[model samples]
Target: MDQIDLDLLATLEADARLSFAELAERHGLSKTPVWKRVKAMEEAGAIRGYAAQLDAAALGFGIEAFVQVTLQSDAAERFEAVVMAHPAVRRCHATTGAGDYLLHVLCRDIAMMDRLLRREIARMPGVVRTETIVSTRTVKDRHSLASAAKALGKG
Candidate 1:
């Protein structure tokens, strides 16, 4: 992608609701070209999809916790499949540490979180053990991939 494409992506990353005409005006281009560029990015899988950012806390999701999970030797696939299908799990990462997977989970309260841990999570595919760390406050939730790409000279 060129500088123009990178700029468009950065703008969209900040606010995906912006119209093509607005993006064009911001980038000093016409609507057609801007729309075409965005469409091209979408087709090429650079721009995956657009979504509305929701306030989890306002939506009654009060507790945010991170779990470091260690599974049995041959249960990675099943464990990951279950994690992917689970709704309360916001994000899951396969890591390189002693723990095999790291899970970010959201719940309505501490009791719900505890219940989820002891019931659902414990009964998942091959959960050997898990360590939970609850967040007091979210200092930072998600970062911009477009900005990171530009900073790393990958855009």
Candidate 2:
């Protein structure tokens, strides 16, 4: 993407609540082009819908963890179904490292996490083993393309 597009994404990352007029003015561009750029980004799947960041602890999801799961088989469809059924599994990714799936989970507490793991997670068909890494602190949490760009040495 061009510099202008990157700048627009950066501004939006900082504040998605900015009005179209405000964004246009800040970028020194007319409203029409700014609108088009934003629309194109959305159409191209670059801009997912904006969301309000919430505090997990305040929301009663006090426990956060990375749960690495190993399964008996690497069958994609079966794994997809199992992963999709668990709402507490925030982010599930198939990886080539130590485990088959890496899941980001949030729960009310350790007890709740344990209960879920026993009743919901461990019961899944073909699940072999699970290892959890509890997050002591969240140093940084961002859901923005701007952060990703900066990590990639593009921003």
Candidate 3:
């Protein structure tokens, strides 16, 4: 991708709802070329898909928790599959640390969080133990990767 593509990515990252006309105006280009560039990006898998960023608290999930899960040696695949299918789990990562995996979960209340920790997650396939940290507040969340790409000299 060139500078125009990088700028387009950054622009789209800020607001995916922008129309091709708006994007073209921002980039000082015409609608058709901007649309073609976006289409190319999509076809190249640079742009996978887009969705609304929902408010978890507004959706009734007030409690956000990070769970560090340790599993039996051979249960990685089964544990991942179950975690992937679990509704409460928003994201999971396999990391090198004290725990085998990190899970981001949401619940309506502390009571629900407790149940999730003690019953649901603890009972999942091959869960040996889990340690949870309930977040008091989120300071920052997800952001665009455009800056990172530029930093990596890919832009």
Tell me, by lDDT, which candidate is best.
1
Residue pairs with backbone overlap in model 1: none
Ranked by lDDT, top first: 1, 3, 2
What's the residue-level lDDT of 107 in candidate 2?
93
Query: Which regions of candidate 1 deviate over 4 angstroms?
Result: none
Best by TM-score: 1
Please provide, for model 2 over 1-111, each residue's C-alpha lDDT reduced to its tens digit, 9 standing for 90 to 100. 666888899999898999989999999999999999999999998898899878888889999999888888755577679789878888898888878888899999889
Per-candidate local distance difference test: 0.93, 0.85, 0.92
Error of 3 at 19 (Å): 0.9
**lDDT by residue (tens digit), candidate 1, 1-155:** 98788889999999999999999999999999999999999999999999999998999999999999999989999999999999999999999888999999999999999999999998899999999999999788789888888898976
For all the candidates, what are their Cα RMSDs to the real structure?
1.1, 2.0, 1.2
User: Which pairs in model 2 have colliding backbones?
Assistant: none
Between candidates 1 and 3, the lDDT winner: 1
Q: Rank the candidates by TM-score, best first.
A: 1, 3, 2
The estimated TM-scores of all candidates read: 0.95, 0.90, 0.94
Clashes of 3: 0
